[model samples]
Target: MRVQLFSDIASGAYAQKLLEIGEGLLGTDQDGMIPFTQQFCHAVESEDELIEKVFPNMQQNIVDENWLCERTILAPKNETITKIYKKILAEINTETSVYNSIDTVMSSDDTTNYPVEFLNSLELSGVPSHKLELKVGEPVLLMRNLDAPRLCNGTRLRVTELGRHIVKATILTGEAKGDNVIIPRIPIIPNNLPFNFKRLQFPLKVAFSMTINKSQGQTLKVAGIHLGTPCFSHGSNHSAKECRTPVRCSICKRTHHSLLHPKDANSSEENKTECVVNSSEAGKKQQQVLLATALVKTICRNGNEYSIRALLDQGSQASFVTESTVQYLGLKKTGFTSQIAGLGGN
Candidate 1:
């Protein structure tokens, strides 16, 4: 029997692709062997065929939730594997918790001094006094100025309730010995630092944005995207004014920037997942020879323009974008670019 399948446009096209493989399994001969024949394909080919081949249990997992019978993550009573796992976790903790200092000052009053440039505004953005402890930043450095040090990009800090005052440091430059003193609502201590610098070094959380195109080949549970309402798809298509940039809808635009990058696929953990919000239709394009969808995770943004392309794989090696589609879209090329492994480009 011969099966000719066209790519179906449905809400669950991806899931249906999986189901196709399940149906193909019924065609095995008595020997249970697939014919060893290969066909030349185009630039954007879905690997549903091979995907189905590798996942024989997918048939079982498709309907049976109990078969998922998960294994326990709990460490066995003295298993060497547990020790190794814990050791690695401790090592990582040690590495990440160890923050460095450009200079060390050992004064009788337990105070360290920093240059004027080492300071930046300590903006907890105004944490209410009652909930101050709820804030995550650990004031690692007692900067002499209000400005944050350029080098302290990843440092986390929490200021003490009082002593942050009296820690005098110069905030001015030139021949004048400026008598500017730094004042904080609180003194500071580092929590992540080990017992050695536990009172100083700090760690803080920071947020970053990535485009949908850069995330193509990746699988994230949830992602945050910034699809503005006036996307490339906005305005009326009936006007026929030659060309148009698609704009996103109200639902896609209002999502917070932090929610645009998804962290995982359809995993059980929902709370820790990442979220994706649509950015402008700047990423989508139609190609005759290649059918693609932006790898929501692999997309990246440097400045004005972001990169978007379908991962030409069903969880294979790489991500891709067509040169022809990009040119037609009239987007600026970023200075730094990398090649997608399977993307057919010069």
Candidate 2:
């Protein structure tokens, strides 16, 4: 009863194999790493080979919106993306248009605090750069959600014409595919920044190459991945569980992930000896464990202050103070009992 299929039988099987690889259903080598097979390696040996394979006739089909829409080059970092973009742009014999943004702080008096030079240098996520360089027939991706169903965010477009106030582009995907639209200079305020500032520029970036994260939800007929640097997160193609390579812990010299090693296991033998001391009254040796602690002043209900030592336990679900310190400061206590488990279910 399915109305349509997004992929063919061959592509569907290929995607299933990728899912199996990611889930660790496929067997690994002694190092716990997946062996590279020709069936799975749809890769090129060099960047030139990749670019030529992805875009066969760069100059001829550079202005073809349909051709550009079906292909993209994905990289792990923005710097690699920029390099790919410049390489692709250089192949096309067209005049480049440089559009500089008018950046200003929200507060007029705070202009000195955040200069235009500083703002121009910043390259925040989900925001276009201060200098937007483009050329006619070049593909650009929308950065903001301007108009849903027509010019929404992530919508790929090809530049038809460039202007000082606005740029004319044709939509390459969705229901409005092949439809021409105007992109104007909009005030973009990055929400992730600490201060408020406005960047007045066209919300578009060169889509000849883009970061892998930005390529999510996008289906391309031809795609090239630039692995100049190793991906640091699970979102980009691979996860830690899918890794077949064995790792060694630096702290304990154990054959496991370094992050799984205990923080206190790095203590020297001398430090361990100092922890054990003989008690004068009981004449028995007692071991004292060191924990992270912080000294702070606490104010009670009567406005009286008392200095208290607080243990910093990142694994704890709730904060706790000693009963003697609470009673001495005349602080109200809430009675709530909860079962807690530690290492080895203790």
Candidate 3:
């Protein structure tokens, strides 16, 4: 069952070439590394130039829903995306509406511990901001799954009307295209935080530009990527590492990516050489370990406080500190020997 409908969407050679590179098939050299390239790779110098290249004739088609729906700019971070959104929004001649969120701590006892200002300042992933700025006719993205198959997360929409309590938007993407939906102020709680808090705001973000991770599964006629910051996560690293454009390191003046430049260059180079020499011998994949850590202040025997990174192990019944940290803190320790379980329960 060959489906020509979806296959026909990426019929162009350029689009197919990009798709192949994304699938890790077309852009690498014979050694499966280094100097990745493709036919459609284009580089821009400045942010202004990048925006101009992506959204040409911006003033003429700023309000065109069809024009806006077909194009978007993606960036590695939300801060960079917000800057791009502001730049594009400033050019459009429309009255802007500002909506502020009501933030509150989940527990009344923690209200004093976590002030409203501190709660509002938090900008977590998938959570709406404390303050939202909007303009009629501009595009926005749904941050929450309001109605499945119509108003779901990542759904792009154009603002048709803006009010104090609610926003009326027309769906620009998916099966609900051209459908006008009402978005209301709703309570949103983020799950990945240490403390609990609730923010009452419209579950939407300005979609003139958005994070690269949010752009996945979206089919756009024109797309611009802002690589002002290097992609750090595994998913983004794979997506953006195909560009062959040489980036110079500011610290070492080397022909390598900025993220690869280490603080101790000499030691890093030696480690890299050692790894390359042992590459063939290490055929098995290494397991990755994730530890929860926090920076806390430790009081020494002399009553001096020093900040140190501490690993948090909730499952362990006993706590352990490093010898260096104990020495640095000048703390007295009584030695005790006990059988300890190691990796693989040894």
The lDDT of each candidate is: 0.27, 0.75, 0.74
Q: How well is each residue in 1-346 modelled by candidate 2, as lDDT tens digits?
A: 0011123455445645654564567888998667766676676789988899999899998867778999999887888888888888889898999999999899888888999899999888778888888999999999876776577667899999998899999999777898999999999887667789999999999998888778754668888888877766556555546555565445554443333222233467543322244344465544333344556898888998878888754223345667898788897877888764432233
- Which numbered prediction scores highest in TM-score against the true structure? 2
Model 3, residue 216: C-alpha shift (Å): 1.8
The predictions' CA RMSDs to the true structure, in order, are 23.3, 18.4, 15.1
Residue 172's lDDT within candidate 3 is: 94
- Tens digit per residue, CA lDDT, model 1, 1-346: 0112223343234333333333353244677533422331112233233223322344234222222111111111212222322332332212232222222223333333433233222222111111111111112222212233321221112222223222222322212223343333332332332221112212221111122322222222222222232223444322212323354223333222222222223535643323233333555432212224443333223334444554342223232347775564554667666543222211
With candidate 1 superimposed using the best TM-score fit, by how many Å does residue 16's alpha carbon deviate from the native? 9.3
Residue 216, model 2: lDDT of 54
lDDT of 3 by residue, 1-346 (tens): 0101122332445444544454466555687643534446567779898888878888788668889898889888999998999998897788999999999989899989999889989998888999899998889988876776577777899999998899999999888899998999999987788889999999999998988777755667788888778766555454434555465545554443333322233345444311122233357432222344567987888998899987754223346888998799888989888865422233
Q: What is the lDDT of residue 305 in candidate 3?
A: 86
Q: Give candidate 1's error at residue 182 in angstroms.
A: 39
Worst 10-residue lDDT window for candidate 1 reads 126-135
- Cα misplacement distance, residue 197 of candidate 1 (Å): 45
Runs off by more than 4 Å, candidate 2: 1-7, 27-35, 233-346
Quote model 3's TM-score. Answer: 0.61
Estimate the TM-score of every prediction. Answer: 0.16, 0.64, 0.61
- Collision pairs in model 3: none
